[model samples]
Target: MGFSTDAIHAGQEPDPATGAVSVPIYQTSTYAQTELGRDKGFDYARSINPTRLALERSLAALEGGKSAFAFSSGMAAITTVMMLLKAGDHVISSANTYGGTYRLFVHIFQQFGISFSFVDTSRTEQIRHALRPETRLVYVETPTNPMMEITDLEAVVVICRERNLISVCDNTFMSPFLQRPLALGFDIVVHSTTKFINGHSDSVGGAIITARPEHGERIGFAQNSAGAILGPMDSFLVLRGIKTLGVRMQRHDANGRALAALLADHPRVGQVYYPGLPDHPGHEIAVRQMDGFGAMIALDLGSLEAARAFLNGLRIFTLAESLGGVESLACHPASMTHAAVPQEDRQRMGLTDGLARLSVGIEDLEDLEEDVERGLAAMKS
Candidate 1:
């Protein structure tokens, strides 16, 4: 089946019991057993849920993985992945990873004796140089948050395979509709389903899709042990949202290109960070790996005051932190998304105080352009 067909139909068959067109939310906490030991596959909601299982199946199919596990939030999903390693394990990560991930590693995981090395994974050589005997995993975010740096996944995969290291890619920005890291040989792919997979911004959830059965088993174990499973209602929501992912992502890609062009050409804008842009350093690599450039774009206004003026001036685009919603959102990374990282680290990653990250939505291009113009006009003032 085609991508759109799979999006709408994979793991979304009519209800076997009721023949309902939509997958019903299995809302019960526990299923009644036929006898003491004989029962359905589901025993408990936290460990197994029909609605959540449907979502996992759909996402696993979408990502071309062996299986997927849904979590209460993106952080929970990431935390579970971290559980795959022991205390002495080390991780190599992108320097411009999301602030929340950075915070999780530095504050929480470090306390558990796990160590990390943040490097510019866009430079595959850096990843190689940072490897240690204790290195067990490579956590990467291509077209990395706000900075929009693209990592060469094929190269990273080769390095990890040679070193016998687990390779995990955060597919939140591109979504499975745009990029499938598993196809690129990544051992695992993670998503903040709160973003593109649930494109409406109405729900918050996360997912981990494993290419290998071993990863699926371990992540599933951690998910059950931690009991951070996504609720049935949220699972249903994400499943519904994914049905329209193919169509939504197409519109997102189109609008993203238009917005990136507008920002790059604007006199007020400086250093537009979009892999879709022809002049962008990662454009070629992105073209080689991704089906389409996504809607996330970042630009520099030169100072914190200017960024504030631009954000406050926008009318259509909401000033918010999260992205990948149907309605556009603009965020200041230095203060909003990456603020958890120290100022020095953010600076080293090229995330300046003046940077503004835009989550281009499915809104009409002309309206979004006008709103951006309004922000630029305010910046000038």
Candidate 2:
């Protein structure tokens, strides 16, 4: 079947006993065992839950990967991947990556002896020169958080393979429906299903899908041992959201294009960053690797005061922290998402005080554009 078909039906089947079309939430914490060791497939909820397993199966199929694992949040998925390394190991990651990921690397993992180098993975040469003998992984986020920067997955994967490093891609911005990094030779793909995957914005969840069974087994072990697995209810919600991903993505792409075009000509706008725009720095590569340019866009309003005026004037777009919802959202990366990163580092990554990230929604283009115009009008003051 196709991506949409597989999403709705891959691991999902009518309940054998009830014949319910939707996967019922198996809310039990434990399963009965015919023998001391085992009975059916499930023994405990933490190790495995039928609903979570179904969602994992869908994620695997969506990403064309060997196996998938669910976690409490996206950071949990990332932390599990970090566990794949130990003390004295080093990893190179995109400097424009998510703030939470940056915080985890610098404050949490660095204290444990693992080292990291923040470089422009979009410029492969930076990654090439950052390699150390201990470097075991190269992490990247195409259309990186806030900056909307694109990294060539094939190029980075080749570098990782040649150096015998694990290549992980944070595919949160471009969900599996838009781009599948595994097929492009990436070893692992991670996502915060809280956004696009669980499109409803009702649940907070995360997943790790590995291109190889070996990587899957390793991550599965961490999930089972650390026990940050998503609950049966949230897993069911995420599974429900996946069924409509194809349709939702279509609207997102359309809205993104409309908004980017309008903003490009707006008198108040500065540095519009949407990959779908022909003038965007990464437009050519995006056209090559992605099926759609997605709804996420970022821009600089020329100054922090101007950005505040625009943010305050928005009526339709919610001023919120998270994205990938049915409704539009606007956030300030310098203060909201990347606030934890030191000022100097955030500046180096191009997350300036004037930068505002917009998570354009599936709303009508006219309404969204009018709301954007409201923001621009506020800037006139």
Name the top TM-score candidate.
Answer: 1
Q: For each candidate in the order shown, give its overall lDDT on alpha carbons.
A: 0.94, 0.92
**Candidate 1 off by > 4 Å:** none
Residues 1-381 of candidate 1 have per-residue lDDT tens digits of: 788898888989887889998999988899999899988787889999989998999999999999999999999999999999999999999989999999999999999999999999999999999999999999999879989999999999999999999999999999988999999999999889999999999999999999999989989999999999999999999999999999999999999999999899988898999999999999999999999999999999999999999999999999998999999999999998998999999988789999999999999999999999999999855
User: lDDT (0-100) at residue 232 of candidate 2?
Assistant: 92
Segments of candidate 2 deviating more than 4 angstroms: none
**Per-prediction CA RMSD (Å):** 0.7, 0.9
Q: What does the lDDT come to for candidate 2?
A: 0.92
TM-score of 1: 0.99
TM values, all candidates: 0.99, 0.99
lDDT of 2 by residue, 270-368 (tens): 889999999888899999999999999999898899989999999999999999998999999999998988999888877889999999999888999
